[model samples]
Target: MTLSGGNARQALSRRIIDTCKAMNASGINQGKSGNVSARFGDAMLITPSGVAYDALKPMDIVLQELDGVCAPGQLLPSSEWRMHADIYRNRSEAQAIVHAHPTFCTALSCRRESIPAFHYMVAVAGGVDIRCSDYATFGTEDLSRTMITALDGRKACLLANHGMICFDGDLDRALALAIEVESLARQYHHARQGGTPVILDDEQMTDVLEKFKSYGRQPRD
Candidate 1:
C-alpha cells in the first residue's frame, strides 16, 4: 500500500532510522559514523548528525533540498549530507544511500585500494570493479566530487582513506549492498593474505551482470 502526504514522510523517516540501526547491528557500521538517507520529492531526508540511531525519532530526520538548503529548526543533517545530495542529483536511479565504515571496507580504503573483479560476485556492484575515490577531506565538496567520480557506472565505491558508500532503489537494498560490499572486501583481504587472487575476466563479469538482471526475481505468469 502507498502512503501519501505526512504519512509518507513519516514512514520514510522511520525506515531511515531502522536502516541506520540495522547497519550497526549487521556490523557494517559503528556508532554514529555512518549515515543514511532517502529521496523525498525535490528534497532528501537524512539522518541527523551525531545522534544515536536508537534515539532517532521520525521527527528527528532532517529534510534538505538538493541545492543544499535544509529546513529550519531541525537537527543538522549528517556531515556527509553533501555527498548524499550530490549522488541523488547526479544519479537518477539513487532512491536511497548508505555510507559506512565497515572494518574490511575501511581497511581497503585506507590503502586507497579499489575492489577488483577477483570474484564473479563483484558484478553485484554493477561493475567489474569498485573504484576508490581520490582522497578528500570528509564532508567537503571535494569529497562529494571525488565520490561521484568513483561511483561512475557503479552502485558502490570506497572513499579514499575513508570508507564505503552504496545506493539503490530503496533503503533496504541500499543497506544490503553496503553489507555485500563489505563482505567482498573481507573476502578479497583473505585472498590476498594467501596470495594474489585470480580475477574474473571482463567477459565473464559481463555475463554475470546479465544474469543478475533476473537474479532472485519471482517468475512471471
Candidate 2:
C-alpha cells in the first residue's frame, strides 16, 4: 500500500477514504464536517460534499482540477475544495490536505489564541506557533486567501473560528500531525488552568529542529 509508484493515485484515494473513516470514528470530526484529498498528477481525489464517511466508496470520491473544476464525476467535490485546491497549487510541496474541526483545536482557534510553542513537538507544525488564519466564511474566496496566508512555508495551520488544516507530503504524516496538534491544544488548555505555561526559548527550539533533521523523519514534502 506504499504510495511510491504509478499506482500512487489509487493509494492516495484509499488513504483518503480510510483517514476520513478513522477521523470520524476517532471523533476528530463527526458527520460531514471534514474533507480529505490528495494530489494525483494535475488532478486530485477528494471526498465529495455531504457524504457520510462510513458509507464512502472509492468511486464516491470526486476527481477535480487543481483549479477546482469538477472532473467527469457524478458527485460534487467538497465545498471546501477551493481552499484545498489553492493550497496545493500554491504549496508545491503539499501532497495531501485534511480539514477537520477537532474539538480542542477548534475551541482554541475560536478564542483568537494561536497555539504557542509550549511543547517541543510544536515544531511538528513547521513553526514555533501554529498560526491561525482570520475568520472567513467557509467555502469562499476570502477563506481560501486566509488559509494560504497562514500556511505559507508551514505544514499545518489552525483555521480562525473554525478548525484545523494539516497537509504534508503524504497522508499518514498529515493525519498524525492533525492528531498531535489536537493533543497539544488539549494539553495547553489544561495547563493554562494551573498557571502560565513555560515555553521553550528560541535557541532551544532551534536545537530541537536540528535533532528532528538528524532523525530524518521531518515531513519534508
Q: Which has the greatest TM-score?
A: 1
Pick out the ten consecutive residues of candidate 1 with the lowest summed lDDT: 63-72
TM-score of every model versus the real structure: 0.98, 0.91
Candidate 1 lDDT over 106-218, as tens digits, reads 99999999999998888888999999999999999999999999999999999998999999999999999999999999999999998999898889899999999999899
**lDDT, model 1, position 173:** 97
Q: Give residue 5's error in model 2 in angstroms.
A: 12
Cα RMSD (Å) per model?
A: 0.9, 3.2
Query: Over the stretch 1-221, how does candidate 2's per-residue lDDT look in tens digits?
Result: 35555366556677799999887777788788989999888888899999898888777888789877775635998989998899888988888888999999999899967888888888887776788899999999999999899987678888999999989888777788888888989998998999999998878888887777666556678
Q: Rate the local accuracy (lDDT) of all candidates.
A: 0.95, 0.85
Give the C-alpha miss distance for residue 104 in model 2, angstroms: 0.5
Clashes of 2: 0
Worst 10 residues of 2 by lDDT: 1-10
lDDT of 2 at 118: 86
lDDT score for residue 34 of model 2: 88
